[model samples]
Each structure stands twice: as C-alpha cells, then as structure tokens.
Target: MSASATTRFGMLHGTALGEGSVSVHQYLGVPFAEPPRRFADPIDWSAPFEGGVRLAMRPGSVCVQPTVTAGDGFQGSEDCLFLNVWAPAPSTVPLPVLFFVHGGDFLSGSGGEYNSSRLAARHRVVVVTTNYRLGALGWARLSEGRANWGLKDQRSALRWVRSNIAAFGGDPRRLCIFGESAGASSVALHLLSPASRGLFGAALMESGSPIATPAGAAEELAADFFRHSGCGEAQRRGGQAVLSCLRAAPIARLWRAASAATAPPPGGGFLDQRTFASVVDGVEVPARPFELVASGALARVALLGGTNTDEGSGFVLPAVKRPLSAAAYTDYISKLTLRLEVPRANLSDVLAVYPPRPAADNANSRGNRAYLYRFDQRARDDTSEPVDWGVTHGSEVPFVFERGSWIDSGNTSFTPAERLLSVAIGGMWAAFASRAQPLPPAAWPAYRNGSEAQLVLSIREDATAPPPFRVEVPPRARECDFWERLQALVRDKEQRVAAS
Candidate 1:
C-alpha cells in the first residue's frame, strides 16, 4: 500500500499523537503533559496538537478507578487521562458540543459507559467523554495528599475543548457540561470554582453536588482510607505509599480496599456528609461551593437540576435498616425542620403538602430557577435478573442513550414511550445547550423562593406539575433560628447571674 493509502485509511489529529482509529476518523490521544506518579499534576496549558486536523476515532481512557469485584459492569485503569470526541462524519455547522463528566461519588466510574451514538446521530452534535482521577487519586487529602486533581483534570479537558473543538466542527462558545452522581456534584463545584467559571455555558446536574460534603469531614475520610491500606510505615506523612501500592498492585486489590473502607455500608459511606470527598484545598477549591451558592457566589449561568423519584433508595436499602415509616418521616421532618430553622408552623404545612418518598427528594427546590423532573418509568432487563430499580441513581442514563438496542426478544424492551422520553430528555438537554431555555411544553419554570411551582416531565407527552410538586424541605435545614435562641438563653442566664 502506498503512503497515500495509509493517509486515506488512518485518522490523525495533530502531530502530538501519532495516529489511531476506532471504527472512524483519525483518532488521536494527545498527551498534554507528563502525568505525575502520584495523584494530579499542574494544569498542562501546552498546545501539543495543531487545531483543525480530523480527530482519529475512539473515546478517551477513563481516569483510573478501583475495578469491579462482582460480575457488576464496573472496571478501571490508571492511564485514563484521555478524552474522546465524536462528530458528524463530515459537517462544519459549528455543531453544539456535549462534554460528559462521569459520576461515581468522586470515587469510581469512567466516561466510557455513555455512548455518543444517539446525540451524534440524532441531533448532529459532537460528544466528548473524558477520564479524571477518581477515589483517592482524584480527591483524597492526606496531610500531604493531592487535593482536587480530578477537578483540575476537568479544567484541563475544558481548555482542550475551548482550544481545539472548534476545528473539529464544534462550537467552542456553545458547550454543555453533563454528569451524573459525582460528576453532577463536580458540575456544581465547577459552577462555584472560579477556575472553572468560563469552561462551560450551561450545566446539567443529575443527582449530586459539591456542596454536599464539608471539607473538614472529607480530609478525615482520606486519612482513614490511607490508614486502612496499612501504610503507617512511610515517613512521607501523606498516604502516597498507599496510593502507590494501590496503583502498582492489581486493580482488584484497590477495589477491595476501597470497598472495605472503615466507613460502614449504605448511608455511612466514603463520600457521605461525614466522610472524605473532594476537599476544599485552598489552592484549588478555595471554599465549599455550597457555601458560595448560599452566599450567592456562583456563576450567573442557566442551570438545570433534578433527581430521581428514589434518589437515595438505590444506595440505601430499607431492608437492612427498617424502612422509614410515616412516624419516622414525621420525626425526620421535626428534626430536619429544626435544623433548617424554619418556623414550626411552616414545617407542619410543608410536610403536610409534599408527598413523603422516604429518600427521593429534590435538593434545590426553592430560591432558584431550575428545571425539575421525576423519572418514574421502570425497565426490565432482558436477562432473567429483573431491572425493576425504580428511578434509581443511574436508571435514566441508558434511556438517554438507548444503550444496546430497542428490539426486545425477552425482558429488555424499551417501549415507544420510553424511547420518546429519552429522546425528549436528551433533546431538551441539547436544546438547553443550544438555547438557554428548555424544550417547549416541557418548558421548565424558573424557581421562586418558597413556591411550589416547577415543571414536572415524564415519558408522557403532556408535561404537567405533579400535585404537591414542591419537595418537603425540613426547617432545621434552613438552623440560624436555633443558634439565635441558644445565644439568647445564654445571655439571659448570664444576666441573672450578674443580678445575683
């Protein structure tokens, strides 16, 4: 074969990554900088690839994470700092770009699972998936452990998109960032992180946020995680020895270690409120994003946020702990309401109004303009093992991409309605990326403080608000009042003592 023949067959991006392909164009894996032996490296702003060359096919490697133990579909690797882009074979209308940040509680999950076929095929858009450090590699903060390297990886990916995506027939200015779970939470963090301010225009947070975890608790979790790996011998102070051991050892061992975290199962977790999470490393995070949001220190970007009907039910099974009964829910409201510091009367009325789903509830229900939806559709996996997980954490993802195929010979059959809903959801997302607003009919309403108004979308064509749509926000959740009363009581006691 002549040199011309090689040129015609293979796809090449820039000179940085030689040449590669995966069922399509010149696929290139451009290394922006040398990855550190430890967790993350400084941002690599070097321009390794010349813009405009056709990118070779194949999605980027997923940032390394612990491997899956059981037959469950989880797997990972360390050489995962790659990013992949898919566009219409040969079009140049400056297509809208979609960047995905995979979710695994900032601990696991890769960008590999999400298929780009539907978005690339149906809407004529470019879809990019990237890998970021996960678990300890991404966010663990030992006395000397790297902090927010995963988030820095995200920033590097965005810089890559801004600089080169336009050459691949994508609009650099028109970008939509999407993620589920930790990815979603990362999106929230990005919104608040000044370093990530201009990386994306619109945002879609599936079921997580950066504000959920406090920094002090997260560092404690990292310290415990390292201790669990039996790394007390190293004088480095950081858990680097443990990190190095896990990185060098078989992937399974790391997964086992991560799974065996001293943190208990179910509610008590490695990334729970009381556990380690992406830390507020002064250099990278600066401050908790949730605090910024509460203080209105957020980017003025159009946002869309919502959760599944059983948001927390999948991770937390009631079978282990007794199901949350009505009385338990009442107790929950009384306690949480007190924490939020809402008036006792408001707590009673809000609890009376919103349907109690034990765990499934919206996070940002009031004081913002967010498009909200509840996915109630259930699916049955083709295999004998039923997939009746009701609106679980990841239930809506496959639908959005129609993973395998639609022809159901057995249990795996996506009805037309399901397909429509998926397309609508994806399309709505695409529309939001293209325009700041949502698709019509399903047009979402801007949120108002203490209001019950929100757009409730389902697979059904007609979009309507489910009765008592506003989720129940506990009073204590809002806790200043409690503090004020305690201070007042202290002052009164002091005054009486002075009188005596």
Candidate 2:
C-alpha cells in the first residue's frame, strides 16, 4: 500500500507494509541536506524543492568512501546527503521520534545499512536514519574553521528533522539521538557540543563514548593527507590553496591515500578505530570530553550506554589463530596499547577486569541518571566464523534493530530465543524514546559512581523454551573501575602538564 504524508517541504509518498502486529510507513531516499562540496559545510536545501508528491521508495546513495569489499572501489557521490523515515502505519498521534546516525569508523558504512521498519512497525514510533559524508571527504580538517564536514552534515540533518518531522507524526520536542560505535561517538560529541544542544532531549550511546582527537593529531593527519594526496606541493600557496588542490584531485586518488595513511594494523589501540574521528576544534568540541561532562557543560539528558561482552572478539579474534594462547593474549594487549607503556600490571589488571562475568559495584555520583547494560547473547551457530565471536563490537546492533534473524546466514543463526531477545531489546529502546525509561525486562537501576548493580541481558541456553532471559547483576565491575581510575589519572596528568 502507499502512504502519503504532508510535510513542510510538500507531499511525500511512502510505501506501507505490515509486520506481525504493527503497520509501518516507510519513506526512503529523502534528502535532508544540500549536496556537499569537498571540505565545506553542509547547506540547507529544504526551500529549493518545490512542493509535490515525491516518491521515497528507495534508499539514497551512500556517501563517498573506499569499497569495503573487493570488486567495488569508492562507490558513491559527493551529493549523498539523504535520510529515511519509518513511522507507525496506523498514524499514532505525536509519537516520540528516534533519530539514528550510522557508524563505520567515520570511513565506511551507510545509514541505509540499518533498516528501522521493524522498530517503527513493532513499537509504534517514528524512526529516522541518515547518511552523511565519510572518510577524507567527511574528515580531513585542513584548519580549525574547515574541520569535520561530517558533523556539520549531521547537524544540518537534525535541523531538518526539527523543522519537518511533525509531518510524519513525530514529536520534535521529544526527539532522542541514538547510535552505535562511531555513530555513538558522534552522539557523545554532540552531547559536548554547544552547537548540538537543544536539538534532542535524550541520547542512547551503545558501545561508544567521547574520545576527542587532540589538535596535534588532527593537524598531523591533515599534513599526512596533504603529503599523500600531493597537495603538499602547494604548501607555499597557503592552506586554502592546498585544500583546493586536494579537492580538485581525483576522488579515487584521495581515497587511496586516506586508506593507506589511516589503516592501522590488527590488534591496534583504541585510537586506531578513531583515526578519522572528531577533533577538539575550539568551535565544535571546545574541551576534553570528560572535562565537559565533569564541568556540567553537557545538556541534562537521560543516557543509556553499554558494551558487548567481548568487544574485541570480532575485530581481533579473526586475525589471530584459534586457541588463543596466554602469550598471544598478552601480545595482543601490548599491540592494543596507545601509549609506549602497557605494563605487566596493567595487562593483569585488564585481564582481571574483562572476565565473562565480573560484578558491578559502583554508584554514580553525577546528577543525571544513566542506565548501563551489558549484552551477552552468543549466537547459537556452531559454524560461525571467528570461532570466538562472542558478543563482539557491533554485534548488539542486530538485536536493537530486531534484525538479528536477517544477518548473514553463517554469521548469526538466530534461535527463537534470540528473536524474543531482539523483541525485548527493541521494546526497551522504544520505551526509552516514548517515556525516557525502558519497559519491562529492562527495568533496572540507574548507573551511579559506586553502584554495583548492572542490567545484564543473557539467554538461558538450558531452558526448554524459545528464549528465556534474566536481569543478572552487573558484570566486569573491577575492570571498568580500573579503566575509570586510569582515565582520571591520565586526565589529571594531562591537565597538570598543560598547566606547566
């Protein structure tokens, strides 16, 4: 069936489909921002489009980035600023809105990769997903003023949503921004950004926290890009000249250089995945993230965050041989260190902290309440590659979208229980959007500085039923504590050194 809605931009025609219990309005390939110019801010394009019945049945083209798989290379255009919307088909009056940003280390992936039909249809909410600039085109900050085009694009999309989502039966005031991985990082940065305040009321950060890149690192990457893209030859001509030359270069040539320059080795540090990340540019990200949080510079919003049980399994395990020996684990930890030192003590501390089931034992001291959860559902498929792929990074995404069954066959052979789990998780997200609190099966304590209680989502493999779950106590308490202390110590040292 066809579903038509009257938006400020005009009339939009979307496809309608029914799931088990809910009907959904699916609008795809809707432009949210103007086509991007290389290394430039995104411009608003709402006023240009003449109001008419626009068909939004297909996903828009993704942003420019290197082909992740073989046979396809750099397969997108500069004019790839689009978004998709999924609202309840039966027209729920003034439903809460959830705006999503996708994650691919700021280099790859698209908003279209994650479909929110299941979420909107099943939960009776409005879900929007978007595509922004990526890789060098999205990043590559030549100077303070021209950095982070991707972030600018996202903000523009948010502005569009604020102005137009009422047409889709969405409550602009109750909007919540949520994302996983790099997308989650963006959410965190937005929390710290003055530019992003008042855009959304709540945030759900899954496996991502703000880890702003230092100014020097960003500048260094800029220099590397210039050298690699042959823009350094124009060094004497000034920064704007160099930017112009790089923009004029072939997209392929620029992409290859960016790929080669930022690609880190396997088992790399936390900063590796963040090579093309947000920068601490004075305008966008004014200060250290933790400092911003501690100083109460961020908006007062409800936050929910958690990491998978084995966050490193998918990325690090496949590259290593099976039967990961103690030596190999130690070596892997060493390679994962960002600083010159990965002390034996630190290794032992990390090993001690990240066991399958550590207890949660801290209460939060901050004023705003945050809910923390650990996802621990292991796919039942015995033949799944990376024999040790146990709740790795990005693994929880399928569950959140209720698309666990649709993942690559061999990757995740979903059991009936897993599907139930998906329903539970999706419901929690929807409930949070609607009421700022998760529904049943997700009822748990808010995170506190020293609170030991945690909400764990795990399946009962021994139960005869399809999928049975329990809200177990927090896990990995000590490990998280160690990291927290380490971060505090590091922050103190950096501040002291900066003062000096």
Candidate 3:
C-alpha cells in the first residue's frame, strides 16, 4: 500500500505500535540541509513526509553532536547534523506546533529520545525534535579559530520549519520551540542569534538559563575544549589538521573517548568538557543571552522556561566514581563562584526563603512570565543497580510525552503523585502549545523583573507560586558595565601594542 493507507494504527517514538491511539504518522531522518555543512550544500535529501515516502517507522540519523578529550580519546565527524519529526496523519485542524531542541550543554542531544506520539495524540498538536552537531563539530569558535557549526545547524532546521511544517498539519505561525538542559540554553542562544530571530513564536526552557555562559567564559571554554580535543596539537599541524582528524573520527570513537574521561552519572552519559559551545561569535552570537533579552532582541515571543525539581540530584550516583560529599559540593559551588553572588547575611535569608525542599526547591518569584516549573515527582532510582540515578536530568521525558508505559524502563516506577504530576506537566505543555498561555487547573502568573519575582511552577503546589532564588536579582548590571570597561581597556592596550 502507499504511505497513506497504513492508518489503522501507529507506534510511539520509543515504543511498539499501540492500538488505543488515533491515526499515527512518522517522518524519519528528514534532512533540513543540502549537504549538512556551512560551505557544502546538502545533497538531494529525504523529502518531507510526502506521498508514500517509505515510513521507515521510526526516527532518522542521530545528530552529530561530537566531543573528545586527549585524556579520554574521543573524536567526532561532520555527518552529525540532522533532524527528525513525528505527527498524527491527516490532521483535522491546523494544530499548534512545538519544536524541541535536545540539551547537552550545547554539545549533545538528538530529537530521537523525545517521543511526541502520546503528547500529540492526547493534545492534538504537531510536535518535532531535532539533532544538531554537538561539541566542536557544532559550537566551535573559529578564532582559536573555527566557525560555529552547531548554531548554524539549528538555523537550517528553523528554515525547514518555515518551508515545510504546513505539510504535517502544523501551524508554522503558531510555533513554540522548547527544550531541556542545554536545549533550553539553545533557545536562549537563538534568542540572541540573528539567523534565528523570526523563526519561532514562543519558547520553553527546562533546567537552563541565559546566565550559564558569558562571552569571555564561553570562548575560553572553547579554547580549553580544543586543548582537550587534541585540537591544540592538531592546530600545531594546522587548522586543517584539526578539521581533518575530527571529520575522519567516527561518532562512536569520539563519544567513547569523551565519555571515558567525563561520563555522566550511572548509565546515562558522560560529562566531558570537550567540544566548544556557542561563543560570542561577532555576528551570530552577540553578548550574553540576557543582554539580548533585556535589550529586547528576543521577538517578544511567549516564553516558558523552568528547571526540574531536583535539577542536579542526578549526578549524585557513581558506579564508576565517588559519591559527592558536602565538601565536594562546596568546592563545586566555589568553582562556579562567578555564577551567582550571595552575601553572608543574605545566605540565611535565602535559605529560609527556598529551604531544602525538593526539585526547584526555591525558584525566583518574578521576572518574565517565563513559566518556571519544578518537576518534583517523587524521586526514583535503581538501588540495586551500579548506576542508580534519582529523578534526574532526563528522567522526566517519558512523563511529559505521556508515555506512561515506558516511564520506568529499568523498573523505575513513579507514584500516583508522580503520574499525576506528569499528567499535569504534559497537559500544561500541550496547553501552552495549543495557546501561548498554559492550560489551567491553575493560573500561571507572569514573571516581573526585580527581586523574588519569578513564577515558580511545581508538581504538588500551585504551579504558579513564588519561592525565592538563592541568587539575588535586579542583579547588578555591573557585570555588563565591567565588560564594557574591560573591552575599552583592551582596545587601548591593543593600540599601544600595535604601535610598539
């Protein structure tokens, strides 16, 4: 039969085909680019789910998010840029659309992991997820030097949305781009990118903020990553060598090497610091994301961003490493000293305001109606397993997708409370897509800029309440000012050096 005849049933992204679901349709490995490179145009690529395009059944190529460290021994290739889309066939209404970008510190993640069938089936909306080049392959800075391939890949997908989402019954105009961890960071980055300006109508971020990467720091991190990637030695041979070796390296070899050095907790992923992320590329990326948001660079798109209830609780386990201690935690926090400033006196006040409750334990009260949420479904992990992770980094995916059957893939069951929480989250996400605002059993308040003024969303409590952020807001814009003066000083010093 042609591609249109198999409408009796369809499976979810991560599971076997089911019966209860309505008409299910999938479009795998659709190439958004001509040749998947900045200079090279994508070749004759897969057609959008057009007339009887073979439903290979599931997702397409995994995005080429590569990373490697000399101490570890990983290297990535150019074939990493690609995206996947899923939806219900023959749509009745022009469903609201959601575009998801996975998270991995702007270095890794693909759309394959986020199944939108249940979410689409229940909510009646079209959903899409993508895989972009990770690490140096995507985020590398050319000054070291290299162009930013990662951000470029995302732009390619946005352009694809502009051209083709209508075929899938999705309203391209009513677009919402959302993501978790680094994916959320991407949304923040896109907000600041020239190429990404008018692509989507709204955004939702989970467990990430615009504050994570500053201009100078982001560039230095790329340098350090390059040094770790053996790119420094590769550069000694010439920039071409760096690209040559990386291009030739297989994805598995690269990921394995990177993971060996900085693998994530338990069974999930590693935390290697190789592969650069979005830097203050003179053109694509300007200053910090907040600078753009504050300067009104973002398209005033409706935005929803939040963190999981226990944002960092996942890394607590280590079948391969030592458990983090209070001292280690303190040391870790110290290293991120530049992240947030807390006074000694205010420490007590802040703790009192946030307390050590659960996920998103203490969220800011107001800011933009960023729709902050805390995914606090009672934590679960395999106590018997070598890598027992709790309600962790990627633990909430199944729930949000409404894939209840697969939630506890490794015998990890969530409570009724968790399920209820998950359903609520799924509903809110769907509602947000259906309309710019959240679906309400509860009213999601707007975030006002200033002190404890952010809307904190949670599972148990009113999703729209204000807890307090440990860091102070009305945050001294002094950092931006400091950067300004520093730049001026550097310019003057450069003139002196040049004259000499």
Candidate 4:
C-alpha cells in the first residue's frame, strides 16, 4: 500500500503508524462536509480539493465549545466538520468499517480525542471518527422553527462514509455505527430516523437510550437562551430577528449563555435541565424516540446496548458538596423530578421506584438481532482523591478502543489482566462489526426481550486475573418496571399540559 489514497474529494497523503507486521494507514482531519452556517443543517462536501493533493496528517479544529475547565472560556471553530480514518496497512481484501461518534453530553468532546490506530490494525477493520455541532450551535432550538442540526451533521458524515470508505479498503456494506454516552443516544436517534436507514448495517450504543426532548421542553430551552443571550427582545420581534441577533453575538458570549442556561440548579442531578439532547422536531427527528422504539418503528439492524454498573456516580458524585443523607437523597430526587416536570402528586410513586440506586431489550421483539451487556470492570483512579467511580459512565470506552487511558492524565496503565480484557472486548466489538454477532453463537446468544441472558464483562475480585465472562439477568428488574411506569406517567402529564 502507498502513503496516499484517492477518493472522490482528491488525493490524501496520510501517515503510516506502527512498524513491521502491525501497521495502519492513518488519515487525519479529512473534511466530509462544507463549513456550516450557524444553526443550519450540514451540506455534504462535493467540491474537490483545490491542489488535488492534500495533507491529511494534522487534526482539524474542534467544533466551537466551552473549555473543559470552567471559567476558561471557549475553544475550537465553526469550520469543524472533519473526520479521521484508520485502516490496516497491506490488506488484500476489503475490511469491515467501524464508525464511531463521540460523547460529551452534547457539549464538549471531539472525534480527535479517540485514536483508532490500534483498534484498526488489531481488529483488521477501517475505523472512522467524526465531529458534529455541539451546544447552542448544535442543539439549541434558538427559534421555534429549527432543531436537531447536530443530528443532521451526523447523518451527513455517515453519507460521506457510504460513498468514499470503499477507496480506503473498507467494505461499504459491512459498516457498523457505534458510540458511548451522548454518542450512544445519538446512535439510538439514528436508528429511529428514516434518513439514517440503510447507511449502516449494525448499531451499538453504550450507556444511552432513545429519548428526545418534548416540544414544550424545547420551547423552555429556547426561552432560557433568549433570556440569557439578551435576545429576548429580538424573540418578541420575531424568529428572523432573534436568529440574526444570536448569529451576530460574540461566540464567547453565546457559549457563556448556553452554559449558564444548561447548568443544573442547586442540588440537581445530571438529567436536570438537559437542554442539549435531540429535539422532537417534526421533520428530522419526526417524533419522540422512545415511542418510536416501542411502536417497533426502529430500523431493522443488528443492535447491541449496555450500561456500566455505576453509570451515575461520575455525573452525580462530582457535584456532591456534602455527605448524602436519606433526606438529601430525597431532596435530590425531588429536584430531578421537578425539572422533569413530574407532578407533585406523584412524588411518592417516583420515590418508590428510585431508592438511591437502581436499573431495555427492545430490539429483538421487532425481528432485529440484539444483544446486551454490563461493563462491571472498574478503572483504577490514581488521582490524589480517588473516588470510587465504580465502572462509571464511559469506563468501557478505553477497553473497547484498547487504549491505556482516555483521560488527559491519571494512572491509567492497564494491568496484565486488564490488557487481556481489552483484547477480548475489542475483538468482540470488531466481530460484531464484521458480522452481526459479537461472538460465536454458542458463546453469546441473542438477547430475548424479557430474559436474564445479559453478558457481564468484569475482572475478578482481586483485579489481577482475566475477566470472568459471566452472563446473568440484570438485577433490580422490579425497579426498572416501576421507572418505566413513571416515565409513562410523566409523558402523560406533559401531554395534558401541552394540550391545555
């Protein structure tokens, strides 16, 4: 294989990573769409490069977002719809493709943060990571007429992959879309989106489900934005005036306003005031995602879904300024429900379902092959004050990517046993992408909707041994049932309010 590859766009000179038998052709910062207009859907890149040859070595700018550290302001640019690709070198046959979407609660992450060279070389697959709009630029329904531009950007990237991945030695038909956290939720939204059908053969979501903002909630978010960004008067003037005011505002000011509006209230949980999720716009998103799944309107593709053992600790614990007493826990729940708009009359029922800690196999019932797993392997936190994150949200990502660590700094070196676990998990994921099965049928069976046949990935108690590949029914089945009922109730209340 040469150092350059030609696609419809033009010739791209990439870097060769690794040496000897293990090597990958890595292309960075490849544009898949044109520079986007503020709050508008993405347009696919059709124009060829000016010079015909381009250097695909450096990473592109991140989409405009707030800095990870608070009070640091913003970084990145609006011209940020770039993607990175990694393919095994010296491949004779076209390989499977794994397209990954990153997760940052729809606010602060980039595709560049994940390096896929190892995953591509070891798994013998083509891996691609991409950027999408975030925050006010990506999600906020600044006007009553527009929503889900970020999701549209993702679909545009997928379309680019379908058209050009074959030139990179990837089988276009054998592509899998996977993501973690908000990315996982994005995958769920794509499954329910009509435009995303037939773009990917399989889908995997880690620690997220199909849920969209109701129309009323989206209006509230817009109002918050209007108030914070000083666009309230413009909004009263009309939609066009408000959009012009917002687009002309300083980028930093817009980010600060978005951060302020989206911040949870005092003693609020992660889900409180979550204004960055995909909105239920009648066009792109069509309807509420969970309702679509329940109605069996989801795409007929191979699906895998799971959550970590302690998914909420990372989001909730970091905000805890005091020890949690029973009264404090109840107060936390109250605030959460209030933000979710659950009526006060039903607070007791909500409390009954959620007691400190608790715990969907919707795919199989619709004739789609589906699997579920729980990542119980805990990561070692070598920070000065190492809180027990307990297999927190996103803990499984490094294992899936076979990387030493995903964070900027920490004692993230994997132990011998963890290295082995990483290999196994990565292999399973690649196998699923290659063919709609993660493992041999005898080893891991397809999940049934109402069964206890979930595959649990965890290391032994001592953490010095290989992962015990255990399959069991997830605990707290009754609690899950109660929560499902509560969600339905909440939806009903929202609907009644909307009607009124």
- Best model number under lDDT: 4
In terms of lDDT, model 1 sits at: 0.56
Cα-based lDDT at residue 5, candidate 4:
82
C-alpha lDDT of all candidate models, in order? 0.56, 0.73, 0.55, 0.79
**What are the C-alpha RMSDs, in order, of all predicted structures?**
8.5, 4.2, 8.0, 4.3
**Taking the tens digit of each residue's C-alpha lDDT, what string does model 4 give over 1-500?**
34678999899999988833788999999999999988887999999888998899999999988777867489999999999999987789989999999999788799998988878988899999999998878988754448888888899999999999988899989999999888988998998888899999999888877667887888788788877898889989884898888888988788878877887778875436555778877776677776676577778899887888777666554666567777655555556555453333333222211221111355666677888787888765323334665577788888888776776342347878887888788888889999989988667777875664668888764666556798877556565665667768977898899999
| TM-scores of the models, in the order given | 0.70, 0.88, 0.70, 0.89
Model 4 spans with C-alpha error above 4 angstroms: 70-72, 143-145, 264-274, 321-326, 335-360, 381-385, 408-412, 461-466, 488-500
In the range 1-500, model 3's lDDT, one tens digit per residue, is 11332211222122233315565565665556655653232332444434533354555656554433334443334564556565666577788888888876665557766667666776677788777776545665545324556666777787777667776678888888887767766776776566677788777777655533445655655445445555557856764775666556655554544443333335543332333566665666665444454455655566666544444545443323666577555544443333344333222122222211111111212123444444434344334445644444655666677555333242326555555655666677867877777744235554433322233333544434322212223122334345445546766786799999
Please provide, for model 2 over 224-305, each residue's C-alpha lDDT reduced to its tens digit, 9 standing for 90 to 100. Answer: 7788788887855784688779879998888877765676647663335336778777777776676666566666777777
Backbone clashes under 3 angstroms, per model? 23, 15, 29, 0
Of 2 and 4, the candidate ahead on lDDT is 4
Candidate 3 stretches with Cα past 4 Å from truth are: 1-21, 38-55, 64-77, 144-146, 211-275, 315-320, 323-327, 339-369, 379-392, 404-417, 440-442, 450-500
User: Which parts of model 2 have CA positions greater than 4 angstroms off?
Assistant: 263-274, 317-332, 339-366, 380-383, 405-413, 440-442, 462-475
Error of 1 at 86 (Å): 1.6
Lowest lDDT 10-mer window, candidate 4? 350-359
Stretches of model 1 off by over 4 angstroms after superposition: 1-33, 42-55, 58-60, 69-75, 143-145, 228-276, 318-369, 380-388, 404-412, 450-452, 460-500
Per residue, candidate 1 scores C-alpha lDDT tens digits across 1-500 of: 00100122132442112112312122334443346455556455353335423354455556655455744233555666776665554564787888888876676666655656555666667777777877666666654335777887887888878777765667878898888777877887787777788888877777665543446766566655655565534424543565565456555554445555634657542222233357777656665553455455566666776566555445533223434566545544455444454434443223222221111122333233355455555443423323334555666676665553323232326566665666666677777777756655334455444443444445553533222223333333234234335546766786799999
Question: Alpha carbon lDDT of residue 120, candidate 1?
Answer: 64
